[model samples]
Each structure stands twice: as C-alpha cells, then as structure tokens.
Target: MVEDPHALFDAWLHEAEAGEPNDPNAVALATADAAGRPSVRMVLLKGHDERGFVFYTNRESRKGEELAANRHASLLFHWKSLRRQVRIEGPVSPVSDAESDAYFASRSRASQLGAVASDQSRPLDSRETFEERYAAADARFPDVVPRPAHWGGYRVSPERIEFWEDRPGRLHHRRLFVAEGDGWREGMLYP
Candidate 1:
C-alpha cells in the first residue's frame, strides 16, 4: 500500500494524464459563497505537492471570494477514458507568493493578459468588449507583464480523499483516506 495518500494520488493522476485524450489536468473545483450557496467550475490543476493540490485564479473572482469567506473547498478529478475518479475535500490557503509569481511568469503572455483583462464571473456587455479589454492590456504591457496583484494560486490541503475505480457488472472499487488527528485512516467502501 502507498504509505501516503498523496503518493497514490500522484500515481493515479499520472496514469490519467497519459491515457486521457485532452485536459487531463482539469478538475471541478467547488466553493461556497457567503450565503452558503455552492458553485463549481472546471479549473486546471497547475501543481500538487505534499502541501496539497494547487490551482490559480483571480482573487476577486467568484470562486476566489467564496474561498476567502469560507476556506473549505472540494475538487473532483474525472477520467472518463479510464472510468476512474478522485475526490478531495479540504481547507484552502493561498500558496506562497513566490510560488505564485513563478507560475504566473510561466504562463503565456496572451494568457497573462487575459487574466488581467477578465473580470471572471462578472457580467460582460459583449465578447467585443472583453476582446477590447484584452487588447488594451496587451497594449499597456508590451513587454513581460507582471502578475496581477489580485491573481495568484491556492493550495487545498485535503482532510479526505477518495478513489473510485470501475469494475464489471456495475461493481466498483472504492477506497477512502480520512485525515485523523496527526495522520490518516484508510478504508474501503461498497460500490
């Protein structure tokens, strides 16, 4: 058995990345706003380590504000080609400022500009308006654009992680790891 749940998670993710045709790193991120209403959207997993799973977004965006108000979040990683999935729930925290800067620098110039231009989850008058905003940002920063102060990464330190693998006859294999006081407890469940 993998001593750490994260090790197992890495192995499974690697397999999914190799076998899936597209967007293998995509996951559904779920967050709840101040009113306790939940929202979910597909976001790319940029990095993962012992600290937890990492993703980036605008600090003022809907998900960002939700996470700020309620530090709890969950993620679902589905690989339909392999009929497997992984779910993680945890407390969210902003990744180190240095980490965020490095990742931001690695993004394409156009994407960096797009991030600066987008008021994610906010109403936009039209696609043209959005494109015009992007154009303006591009013009404003004709060189290497600095990462927006309001954009960065968050790390979700999971307290629970579950893995599901499909089997024949509608049966399935399910394993879960729940964080205890210091470590984690692993158990299997009925499919």
Candidate 2:
C-alpha cells in the first residue's frame, strides 16, 4: 500500500545495506539487442532516484552496444538475507558527461587505469597483454585519469516496478506499481 514505489525501494535498499554481507547495491541488468537477443549481467547500482536507477559501463561493451540498439531494459534486485526482491522495467538514456566524469574521478587510481586498459567484451590475447596495457595507461596518466569518451552512465526510467516479500507456507506478498501520467497506479499480484 505504498503510494511511491521509489520510497519503498529506498527503504528496502537501506535495510539491505545494513544486512547484506557484500555488494548490497548489486543488481542484475537485462538488455536486448536490435534482433531481440537478450543478455543479463550483474552491475552495481551507482545511483537511484525518482527519475530511475543508474549504472555505469564502457559504452563499447556488449551491454552498451545492446542498449544503444534497444533502449528498453529491466533490473532485478534480490536480497537473499531479507527474502525480498524488486523488479524494474523501463527505457534507458545516458547520463550527462559531467556525471560520468565525476564518478570516474571518484574511482580508485588502479580501477581508473584498468578501465582505460580494458576492451571490455572484446577478446584479449592473454593476461600479460592486458597487464601491459594497464601498465601503459598507468604510466600515461600519472596524475588524473580522464574518463574515456566511451565510458559513461545510463539511467533507466522505470515504467513498472514490482516488489515481492516472502511469507510463511509458501505464500508471498507481491505488489506492482505502474507509472501513470505523473503518478503511479498500485496493484497486487498473486504469488
């Protein structure tokens, strides 16, 4: 009976942050190519708000390419310890370059160098080659590492959000919220 799905998600995520042992912000992101081929991968939730959920990645990566071809996507957040999960589906758009640059600047130096060195989904000849590339990047940017032009963040503007909570005797509580105009229409589902 929550009026705002974003508020409910914030509360659930707060509880998860306190209880989850690792990566409480981790979420499964699902995307599809222009041909309708689907792919799913785990990514950290960099930010979230009424606008939608946000995550960053290399723009040339497989997921990125897929996102470019198909803007619609889905996100799944499962908190095993709490026996709860949330599903989000929506259209996505890229975040501003300023946002991407700020986030990149906040990352550790090593991570910055790694991102610069990586070809992401592309095949690599060997580990040593990657190490060499990483070393070169580190040497090239001894001070500030600039975010690559191909690296950025994307925001998913949710059209539907579903929350599920576990209960006794195989019963569960499922609530769904669909965006309606500027507000949300809440409903229940059998689970």
Leading candidate by TM-score: 2
lDDT of 2 at 129: 98
* Per-residue lDDT of candidate 1, residues 3-45 (tens digit): 6888998998899889999999999999999889999999999
Worst 10 residues of 1 by lDDT: 1-10
Poorest stretch of ten by lDDT in candidate 2: 1-10
lDDT of 2: 0.96
Q: What is the lDDT of residue 133 in candidate 1?
A: 96
TM-score of each: 0.96, 0.98
Error of 2 at 53 (Å): 0.5
Cα deviation in Å at residue 102, candidate 1? 0.5
Candidate 1 wrong stretches, greater than 4 Å:
none
In terms of lDDT, model 1 sits at 0.93
Which residue pairs show collisions in model 1? none
lDDT of 2 at 188: 95
